[model samples]
Target: MKHTIKATWMRGGTSKCWVFERSELDVPGFTTDEVLLRLFGSPDPRQIDGVGGGSSTTSKAVILGPSDEPGIDVEYTFAQVGIDQAVVDWGSNCGNCSAVIAPYALKRGWVEPEDGILTVRIRNTNTGQILIERMNLDGSEAEAFIPGVPFPGQAVDIGFLDPAGATTGALFPDGKELSTLSVEDEDPRTRSDITATLIDAGAPVVIIDAQTAGLGTADFRQWPTACTAEMPRLERIRRAGAVAMGLAKTEEDAQRAIPKLAIVAPAESGSDADIKVMMLSMGAPHPALAITGSVALTLGAHHPGTLIAQQLASAPDGELRLQTPAGLITTWQRQIDGQLAVGTSRTARELADATLSFDPAGERTENPAVILAQGTGLDEQQLEPDPPPHGRRTVFASVAAFAVLGLGATLVGGGLLNPPATTADGDYAGETLEVVIPLAEGGGTDTWARFVGQELVHDIPGEPGFAPINDAGGEGITGSNRFASSAADDGTELLVSTATTVVPWVLDRHVVKYSFEDLEPVLVNGTGGVIYARTAAGVKSTRDLIDRKKPLVFGGISATGLDLTTLVAFDLLEADITATFGFEGRGPVNLALQRGEVDIDYSTTSSYHSAVEPIAKEGSATVLMSFGQLDEHGEVVRDPNFPDAPTVVEVYKDLHGKEPSGPKLEAYKTLLGLTYTYQKGLWAPKDAPEEAVDLLRDSAHELSGDEEFNKKAAEVLGGYPIVADENLSQRVKDAYTVTDETKGYVTALLKDSYGIELD
Candidate 1:
């Protein structure tokens, strides 16, 4: 049986979490931990089987419920779902994810906004910390800004109430605020002792001087790879500090999530920040300070005799300025209800709203070290907020996924293994749809395949299990040939085709052994892009191609890859251009063009928004023409998305006074048909069961028409259309039929113009 939960994926501060109302996840016969672990595709580094983004910050879950406690609006549980392990660590609180609470509550109508402002009390069930968030309901995206994030969002004010004793019921958990931690190396003879301040407020932390770890103030200025190589010492410090705070009985029993550690140093004179700080989470240098850890660091810096306070030459008038790796963070401290409180500002945004169904019985790789973090998962919470009888944290031995919710991530999510069903009507209850993507994981093609294939299977008969295998090499040809020659011929297997592989085959490259003509098309997608030129190159329009004093320089990944379409377009237009092959990808080519190394480039519709428009608007480049979509009669027409831009055919007509005809134009159209119109697709082996093939295609068709899937796949599709029409099969077959004349033309053009020999 499959269990589904409605979720809202939101980014709070630096961490992103899948938010769920408590009632939606409190179902019977299953624990929230089990549901999240499966939904997140844990025990897999990539988390390809689930929605997890295969990282710490992206693999978190926030469970919110109405709070019956007086003056508190909601109580929430933050689950640190594992990305590459089986454990969910809830030993402490996440201030980063907390930034998401008030906005989510307002969006869900859980809280009411008063006169364009929203104030709500959110209690972190993990640490009994009641946080108050004051959000400007009218805060426009342009009004908010923070460190690490390249863009702005709604700014929120989060204050921790009486945060001092939230963890161990004392500001300084070890009685003394200042202490020395002697971290020993493998050779006990060699020891590294560091001065530290152990505190319990804002999620319990160990604050230390940077110099104690052999780092000085100079390290704070433009520090590259900041402390990544200090893992050994940091781990020792984290474990040692855990014991000093009485959170653990010994270093070996220290928990992975709690008693955070931070290194502090004074910022350079005249710098905006008062002090600079670096944090280590799960023994790795944090890209930025943890929202909760920063609260503690702020409090410690304000306290009279703490290490952080000593580093600050002087206290700030109101806010504490912290210089972190990403940028500067501003924090404030105040008295709330006569109790000490610290707060910071963060901007949050909702990424997606969807229902995710997970299978509890799918697979569970047992790791004895995984300690349950919730109350119901194992009849008890192993790592609770409750301090032990010794007035310290309870020691627990375990390694868990430390997914950090960091910015600069475009969050864009494995399959079960089972036997193949022989017939189309056969239920795939125990079967797995193994998709072979001939590209490296985390690229554009891989992201698309995982998104479509992973979700489309849910609509298939019995909702077969999904497993995507990336056999990346040879720029996709290696994996393509492997799949073509060896993948199961049953319906259980499918091949993913993109321009990288399609172009090679069109040129009849000797490396391409897999014939799309032999495979059956299940589904296909069409994309549109446009050729652009750097205005800096002294070219204003297509007319400049014939009488240019200097030929325009173009950068590309490879002539045999997607670049073939553009190369043919250049040929069709008879453009005076010098082609430079072997950049890396379109992005690099775009960068090179920007840097004036190349004078022209192209961008697909999806990236056109981020990559092209900005430069064009800045008057650095010109959008000369779009590749355009192929119509019923194989005629190019303006893309609905880019209608303002003329088609290449129109450009040719406008430049030369008539529609040019010849081998070059024919070859251009042929390459366009293969590389753009039918750019990406899925195919099943011809020998696969007839019933299975029909059923799979039917599901793909249904999924293609699904309103929800289309909405969710918009970004991944790069504004392309999932071609599942009744005539799609005919269209794909026609496009795949590379005529000998067109093939010979493209082949010769490659060898003559670019000096390439067909393998």
Candidate 2:
């Protein structure tokens, strides 16, 4: 008679394992080990009777159960079953297997799923540590992908918090950074002392220098063949170090598994990894990295005076990239609220879900021939079988379950399903919107994009949410062109534009492939600018600027960008100013002024408040003039935002004794109108459907009026007003329209003054 048990075969990171729910198994406490041993066909060199893959990586198991611990959702125990012995070691946890527990729990309804990134807390019974898994979930689909995994699947980020003492209750289990172990030589009378670092981070690991280990190359692939002759010597060192670390009573008692051995050396030039590491699992070379080993290496890299720290070139910036036999794996480590948090990416895939039948009365089928045929490579046929009845549920069932749980179906069968009309008040009820920002993260444009995206989630109809993707490069040309060429016109994709994008387009830059005219404006963001001067240049007020002797060196970005207005202001005031162009952005230009690299610079209100305000208050810098805002009659007027500062027009009149009017002033007005009055805008393809455009316009209008949005916007946007509806379209037209005379004058000025020619 056969006893059937439910099981899930999965590939976690680079390793494969079988996952089982604890309650489903009928075996008792100590006897459970015997059943698993027989089920995996262990205790024989080539156990063909069961499902062991004949290698340590392929021979692993995880038992999952609902956790009774506070704040932990599930408890998972990782077992390392021996390939050639009836032994099950539950001494340590598998980081790769730990990544899958959360997803499995979510699928089994062990934890409730939330929109956006979902956090699942799990307790690893083996190491007695808690792990947090953060995953991006869009219904049943996940977003991230691990770089080194061979297969295609969603990658989950698992963070081990305060992992320094996960295993042995101390970072250095043996309470020493360096330890010397004496190993017997082949001559039987000779002995050599090897230096190793025995530390417990994600796992207990013994780290040794590759050169001292007599390993010819640091390349892990070569180590398997090159270190074959010295395997016994290395194992002896591991055993000795294990006893010293108190993991074993004697060298013979050490299973040669738990404190895995690692050979390290300096990374080769042109490699992405900071260092090269080769890990051995169960006396064999690991083709790729173990996630826990990566955590251990990360901790060691940060720790002072360890072998890994000595070999490393410098301290890593949050993430540590290590080279392995397979490829590079990056791990990030940081202290959050005094806890050491280590995070790494791992991809999990459900290979097969079925019932495995076993017999206690039947003959043991331990065929070495079958085990040899299986080899060491991943056997997809054996690991993945046809989905069982319980596993092959229909999409309708999932949708019904979501509805009952009060979570609408944002995605069904990987396709977006339109929500009901009442939910969205339109057709785009259950859609996921993406807002593309053409700047790097932490910049003003990215901040604006995030703010708008968050507000849109609240204002847009239905259960729609917006996510921002920063595709920053080519000084904003890359992301703008990407959106123009590839973004879908179904109202799902929107572009976050800044002066960096509009300036290139207006200047006819060769790299600017996108046309502002080809896009439709849905919203316009208006921000004011202030021209400031370094106090060391002897300019405190607008009057002092005209009396200055030395030519004020103005730091600017590009001649055709927003700096055009500042350049024209210099001409209008008849000020002795020399323009130095090619700064990345206003932030860099301000830094140049602060460092005394330049005498004068202009910054948008947002940057001026955050960065320049402190310098101004310290008497290092002085505000000279504000660009101000244009009135309805197209006259430069005092900006309501900066009521204390005089307008640039007022400053020019005060200095030159006349109202500013010329080709320079016209060009300045055109550039100012384009850059300052409507510095940032939300746009979509010109041919976007009228209904979608109206929906977006309405959403923006609602967002602008929202009190919560206004409060947040004041902090992020420097109190800029969000211009929407017809006013937004009119602003775009006014900014883009320029007279032939003004354009010719600006083009010539760019060439003669700044040595820049418009294409």
Candidate 3:
């Protein structure tokens, strides 16, 4: 008598997997491992008897269910079942497969509302967290289509919360953007350690120039020939990195999984797009990992401390195209004001005739050959006169077959590991530092906080840890509530607090449950912001704009709260300027500007400096004046990048000093100061034991002093540390304070100039 277990084999991207529901499996004889092996026909290269594809990466499984939590809608668990081994890793989440959760939930009856764009909040059971998965449905079925997957299956959009330091404890875990580890052999050489930013975005993998990896970018498709000779050496490096990142308890663990690797360089003519790359999966090379891997690598490439940081391209927030074996994967991400909002795309791959059904046990029952567990016994008397009714009803768990994992990140350091440490105040290290950041990851405040964390890992007295948790909605209210109410004064948990928090606290007053006075400042770090423009506006200079070719459309990062200042500036430029709110960052704004969608934005000078410098030098964009209260040579200096551009005061004078007023302006002023607050320190919560805070803070200070940090900072961030100055932070914060009338004026100016309406 054979026992039957149902399953559905699905293909996502280049990867394939067998998906199941928790209610599947009635076999009492098979243990969890045995059940998995039997269902997938594991431990065989052929897997001829089962749906398992031979490749290790493809031989995977996932279990999905409606979320047990109140607010969330779904739950997901991933299993990397080996083809040659019986082991299935229940730890960690797959960033790629994660894209499928919502579709799966929508197709299955686990979630409620069966119609039109349902948001299925998913809890990633593997990482112990929840993530938002947006599913587009027509009625009781899916409507959105995603690339890579077949049959135009539902397209699911995933959003990560507080991803900074998700894998690693610090955004700059090693303190330096590119640190030189003193290995005992092969010279005291310098290797890039961008684990900081990489960890911040949870892409702790290193990307070497393809040439460094001993291949040209054009040769990625010839990998079958290249891997035989060059892959082994790269594998060694990847394994070493895993150890360095502390993902592996030993070097051997790295040999199995973790610290994914990729090599990139300039793309070949007609080779898909802008840049070309080759990504590695386990030991095998990926035809293409898409922009997901690149997104992870972007942090390493852009932030201080990491090898190959210098090889990255610089462009404002927007579409970054990558050429892979499968063609192009375009990543669309940006900072709205100062927070990161990211997404990616490829031509949608429609899976045709892709349909699945489930058995009464919630297991896929479509493949008749797989029902090997069915049994026929001779009990006679009509099966003992029918067993008692147990009310065990299994409904169809037919979902679109994808999952989402968007949990609020608790800072994990070194890109791996979570451990408690005693702090300087003689308190047990806090369980975990839950940092609520008003902005999204990769924003200025978030970036600064990450840098501080990186520095602390090496310099701070304690191996203290904190992660930036982004709750970017309701202007800054959502994030602020998480911070003001949930985060305690204990030194363990802290807020990588930003200007958005201050803006709402001062202006709306109703934005958060607690006042700004309720929170305590741990330290102040650094400052950087930019006044940028897109390439298409056709206005070569401020004068060209003053000449008025057309209404120059400028964009602000936020839709409400703190964006008032930039909006006000646009108001002053209203002679020819037309502005709007809702560009997440320079990247998207740059894309929009290039596409003639918008014109200018107040981006960070430092953030855009590297990416735009080449373009600017090539005369692509005209940098406007840098705005802040900073004095230069006894007077406010114009931006060096655009010496000809006028100051805010000069522009104001030229446009007439008519002031705008109200809570909006007050909010704008408050938000503008976030750029300067970039220099402020980030720490665990105040309620965190004093000892932990001291250790982390002290270690950070110590690491900040390292010569290596200075070098990486200059190379990656394009600037050296300005060091933390409480007085400077205080002054910067003060600049945001304004009367209600002034706030209203600023708000009106912003609305008038940008057509941005704030409630």
Candidate 4:
């Protein structure tokens, strides 16, 4: 008789696999290997009858159980079940599917939501390290939407709780600045003792200059051809480096996985990604690696002992641009020299994000993705992780859990994980913008806005003038409105805000009465989105969701507006949608999106674009439609970032009899018209002095034009250029031309959907 084991099929990164709870596989005496092989359907090219996707990368399994560790919410064990081979590798970690731990914990009842966001502390079973996966909830509900998955998925915000040298023994694994390892390849021309940076953040990796391999980091597709020609050399270097990094116990072990190889080049090199690092799958390069890896490489490049540090092209103390397979990745780093020891490389990765203001007079900006799944429950605790040999015993979980357990688990134990808290706060302090945001520190918008402030301080016309004050609360409007109302018009105080700034106005949910009209636009920054799903189900594409024949629930930043618009489109398409509103921010909403309880969500394109583009390409999620101004200017300029999908207008015309129109139609048009018209601008009160406003705007504009700023912006925006200007009033007005009917309809629509009756 066939052994029928319960398994959950999940899609992580570009791969798919079956998951089994530890309890489900407790058939005593059968080694873990025996059960895993049975799960993968060994020696079968066609795992046709099984959940395995057949590809080596896809035939994987994960077993999650309850963790009794004082600070951890759950314990996760990942098993890479081999296809056609009888081995199951459990030595390294899968950072991609590693994201699923929190969602899974919620589904199994490992964590309980407190208020807005529930922090699920995950003790990585592989590394015995703690990782905090921020889970957001709508009354004990998980919401989050990540890219590269189908439909809207559960959002589980993953942050390394104490991430230091997760792979290698030290942050800068090698004691020397650059290590020279002999090339084992047949190619005599390749350099012997090649310069490489072996740093351990989340993984052990060897970063080399593409030029060292006699190749350029131009296009990723071209690398396959280059690899084919130099396969022997590439293979040798990868293997040798793995041993040097201690990721491999034997020569053959490195050939399989761990200590992945990455090639970095100058951003001006016109490469596919300014820093093109191969993903987890060794045979086929990943479209892009995980964000954790990026952080790891960045840390390695700055240290003296790594190869990346030796080849360091001197960069100013500002934005550091990393070219990768996907595009340019921008990280705003502030270095603390004394902290650059072998195991302690302290730095901050500065990032930016934006919010939008809408009116019926203009086109609607693109609608970002939001969380759909709302996973429930937590598993019963069972697994325990052994601490790594050298590092401090760190547990990465929630503060509340630690407090309740009466244990002392440092956020970054012994300052080994991230930079010290004191240093982290002042990384960009003392010389900057005048505007201050009154929000919690380390928030997405807060981080980006502060980075922009740093840029202005570093390069703008009025250098050392602009300052950002943190006074964030009440959906980021109170602090922002404070800037709009009181800050000097000379552009000292600029409020960085989002669609919440406007959506609430239409809904009258915000106590502060204001609209896009109250603030003068300075320059639009950037935007990103959330992808969502439920934790219980592993549906990779929109097609999978549609096939399931269930109403895929979605959540919104607010009740109506952009999030609702996407659901309405689904409604028109006869796709099931159940949307909830009034969750703290996109951050929490994203956590819910991943739980499978809520199946869809909308987030900024910038945030989720990198993670999601591959999903669209892989046929997992439906592009549905983007909400942005119809590409005009006499020629249709495709979004180079998402080539397969059409513009919002194109999709609308294709889906319905006509394009999106009416008063709300005008609102949609107007919103899209200003899609990139600086959705979230650094603004002051309309009444602020023209000189102050001009000063701030001009400074911001000048900073935006800085070479470093431009390079980083290009990187973050996925190569699509951002237009940052000082005189946004004209730009805003030019994009704004609405009839009274359009205005009334927009207001009415907001009220009907959000329960707010705005005049």
Candidate 5:
């Protein structure tokens, strides 16, 4: 007899799965398994007669129902149906599929919607875990785009509370932060033991260092190929880990569905993510990360001595961003009472709803046809009139039909029934915007790029989302040149320029292949700086600084970079100061000042607040002068943001008993204007269309007026005004201009004092 079941296919995060309302499936325990296996066409390598998508990621199912438990809306059981095996492993919950539960419930009327945010509590029957979903009911599509997913939809915030022991009842199943697993090898010369972290949060996970597995590269793109080649060794290690975690009584009983393995390495320099990870699902590399695995990995990152924890030792608090093959995934964890609460945002959309029908008698049929509504079934030629007993051709035909029908249904349901139309303005309507930050992650430039990119998501016309790509190398020259030479002029590509980039171009450095003149500025961000001295130097004020006998040591970078202004300021003041160059950035220089390695140092206003304010409060450092902001008349004036600190000009006049003037003063003002007043800005290729430039400028102007943005700017940019619209053009022109007299004076000063020649 033929039996039919209603099912909904949905895309959750990067994976797609078949979802079923549990109460509707009347089949009993073992019978239900048999029915689902037949429906999925499992046990055959190709699952030719079933609805499986062939790959492990697509061949998954969820059975959800209204939960009777208090405060819980739904209870869902996640099943991983093997493609080549007639086995349904309920060993773990699928994080990606779990994301669909709340949405499915809302659609099914299992949960009532509220006026604002709807909260849904879910019980994962497989792992006996609770997942809370907070959804915005504004009916607006999610604007945040994740990597790998082609479309954007509604965003759902999922929280896995106390997930540390969801599956195994213990944070570390082995009762140790780090466990050593013994591996039998063909070669005795190599290491026989591997160190791993065996923890059970959303799922049982095995964490190990990529270097230990001989995967030395931190590049995520190379991981899949490397994993495919070393599967046997990796599987052996996984089995050993399973034994260590006590999840398997013997290696033979170890299931590939449980205890997922993840190889991790420290993120490359300038990367926006704290760590780089590659996850393995069902014996193959996952193209994107698993939400369940992310939860487990997040907990491991917080646990001390674990491999993941050690790599994230310096990670910022509150949000932990990880780099995956698909892009950046941010996760947050907080301890409530004694249990750890983990949260992440995921996007899900329902694709189609249909009743699936198949004859149980034809379970072994090689070429079985699936019946769907709306004539969305396989072609007659693809379905055999007489079922074949067994053959590769039948398998091929069945799999092809499944894919074609599935895709057709999705396209028809998703409003992609027709070809996409272009916008009249030729703006970036459907294109993915890439914002390039030519600095290592966690630097000032990266921070600014991410902030601006986030704000641009809402302000830009067509509401195109922005992806910040950190191409840190060659001291900012590599990314700058790549953007100039390769980026298209369709307003989809933008470069975030900082003083690191400006200085290279201004000095005519050999490493710089791109010209500032070849770029068009859209928004210029102004930052202020303060030069201070360590209290140990005994120079409490500008007067004390002049009278001090000791020559103050200034820790700085290359003089041709941001430090050029500080160096020129030192010469103008006639203070006995010697600069020790080659510090990586302002961060290191600030550290040096605290350690007394440098008696005097300057930090941008933002850094001054976070890193230096404490030193000053502790009486370890004293502020001497602020670089200040330019007035309407283009004269250095006291910064309204830091009213207490006097301008460099004020400090100079007080120290020298005369107004500061000369070619040196002109050069100092020129470089200072370039470095502080227009330190960072947004730019596009010089040849970009005029419409694109205007759109970006208008978007930035709108963003600058946003109350939330202005509040954040006060905290990060020291309340400095964002130069946009009419002011932006003049700002760019001023920053790019250096008079011959001023240039000559700066060039001569560098050659004479620092024994360095300018190009």
Candidate 6:
């Protein structure tokens, strides 16, 4: 028999998951799992025959129906359809995919808005947990940018009600916060027992210390892209954790899901995140964090006995910020209706609403597909993963998974993954171009460095080895310091410079031993952004930014990076703001504003359209304020891209009734030029052979002018030009040379205003 049903594809939070009604899948002669597997074209990585996105995050499905539980609005089950396997795993929950349900309910007329806010109480049938979901139904335009989402969508606030023991009946599934798992069988070379926290809140998760995983503290900070060899060990560890949590009978009998394993380490110094994590989803590195994990981590962040609490970088007073491979995602806890509630916001967009017909029985597989048709529990032993030879594993779940495709790249000491470009003609044919990227991988700066390094070496006279090293420590300071002290002076080693690295030197922090004056510029790029504040935070206009009854809470990454400039803007305007200086990035800051955790924030020029514009249009936030651009006279001018937005200095004029002259304004202008206009660059040691530097600059000059490169780099450049002409050095010199007056003001502001004593 053929089963025809309606389904919706949704960009739910961090991923796109299919949503379907429970009634549609109740056809005779087939179980829900059998139909979904065939519909998704599983048992193959490519999934060429089906509509699946071919990754765990994208290949997820949520089945929704009218709630039978008391006080619940709807009932649903989260299913993670296996990729490259003939199985449908209903063992756990997916927090990211769960975001689509509320919006789906509204669209399908399953729920209605109350007082302009669309709220739905959803019951996860698999875990027997209830989630209170919310969004703004008053307007149709407001969007929640959950960092790195390709597009903005309705920001759904999800609160896991009484989020404890969703799966195994106890918050601490193993009857304790800490549990040790033996991974002697998974590892080929060594036997290392792993200590983990098996908490059953939201979803059962096994949080382990990265240092205990044999990578050491240094390697974990960089967030290495490839940990393929470690996946098998982690899988076995998850099985052990499942058995320990009483979710499975034995290690081999453990299902493919539940007790998700994650690598946790203390965040790097000056990092906005409270913890650094490498989340694994169904045997693959999670492209982004699972929403369920965020819920678990938030609850775990405050409990002193949990493993997450031990790795926390902050005092555990506020919301928990997780540093994922994608970026920082924020989760919070609150007392709602006198009940302890935990939640985070996710971006939700309905991608489709359609009906489809599929066979009741799925395509035949070596393993009996009919096992899913039975009403009994999943056959546990059949779900055991096929052990790859030598304990190697590859993921079918993500395009970003750490598969290490046969490209011969060597991973070296100190967390450097060197994928050397092909050597070609030039003075340095045999040499390697080691670019010191002072940021974590998968971030914008890292992306720029890798892209530029690869392309630069491709066309350089001697296309030498390309080694882009990501040394993300001390909020980009550690890598810059290392490059300053030990980089080769022969033009073979180049340091990647962005606001993160330059701001420290601008403040003349004692830790900043490298001076921009001592380095020669190869190329420079510009970037810009606008300032915005949430309307919910007593801010109706720019005037309300100062002398308000309560100060607007400002979220920032650091007091020394690009945020230094914004902080100076706050000082210049005498804006009534209490700056919280440890958000993972501006994206998280934007999310915090949406969730009312913070009030004022900024968005990069590239992300402003997708991240902030919708919210601005919906009257949730006000934009029209720019950091301003640096003109030829080194004066602040209205950013050409944001012509309608007043410059910060101009905004100052409107508020104070005149142009002001002071060190605050001077410092603001200085930071605007350094951190925005002439923000990023490539620098070599001053004593490097001029011929080598000259040749490199010439190549970059040609690259900047090339149509193909410019076209490809348009998005990365963010409407900014890459300067590599003869005058680049002089222009860069003028911008990098921070005046003594500006330096004094910044240092004092940090020390006096923020109570930060810079070393």
Ranking by TM-score: 1, 6, 2, 5, 3, 4
Off by over 4 Å in 2: 1-427
lDDT per residue for candidate 4 within 1-759, as digits (tens), equals 233456656655434545667777664434565455455554234443345566555777778888787866688887776443334567656666665666556666767777767667677677786666655667343433333333444545555554557666677665655677777546556656777766677666677777776566334433422333343466677778777777777667764455666766544454333344443334334444555666566666555555565555563244445554444444433422222211111111111121111111111111010000001111112212322111112121122223322334355544544332221122222223455553444455555565566566554432343334445444454554445445554334566655545444444443454456777776665342333444344454444435456666676654433454454344334345556654545655655554344556655666665444454455544444444334434222345555554554554556555755544445555544433323455666677666545655665666655677778766444443344564467765565444566556656655664454432
The true-versus-predicted C-alpha distance at residue 635 of model 4, in Å, is 40
Question: What's the true lDDT of residue 528 in model 4?
Answer: 29
Which stretches of model 6 miss by more than 4 angstroms? Answer: 1-434, 454-459, 462-469, 485-490, 510-518
Predicted candidate 3 versus true structure: per-residue lDDT over 77-160, tens digit per residue: 887764433335565676566766655565666665544666666778766644555555564434433333334444555555
Cand. 3 Cα-lDDT: 0.51
Per-candidate RMSD, Å: 14.6, 22.0, 25.6, 27.2, 18.7, 12.6
Which candidate leads the pack in lDDT? 1
Clashes of 2: 0
The number of residue pairs in model 1 that clash at the backbone is: 16
How many clashes in each candidate? Answer: 16, 0, 128, 139, 3, 3
* Sequence-dependent TM-score of model 5: 0.48
lDDT of 5 by residue, 287-330 (tens): 56888889889888877778898877485486779887657899
lDDT per residue for candidate 1 within 122-212, as digits (tens), equals: 8888877789888876645315867655456678899988778676788898788688888878586898777899987777788877776
Candidate 3 wrongly placed segments (more than 4 Å): 1-434, 438-447, 465-476, 534-536, 547-549, 573-575, 632-635, 638-647, 650-674, 677-706, 715-736, 751-758
Instruction: Give the 10-residue window scoring lowest on summed lDDT in candidate 6.
Output: 396-405
TM-score of 4: 0.40
Please give the lDDT score at residue 472 for candidate 4.
Answer: 40
* TM-scores vs. true structure, each candidate: 0.52, 0.48, 0.44, 0.40, 0.48, 0.51
Best by TM-score: 1
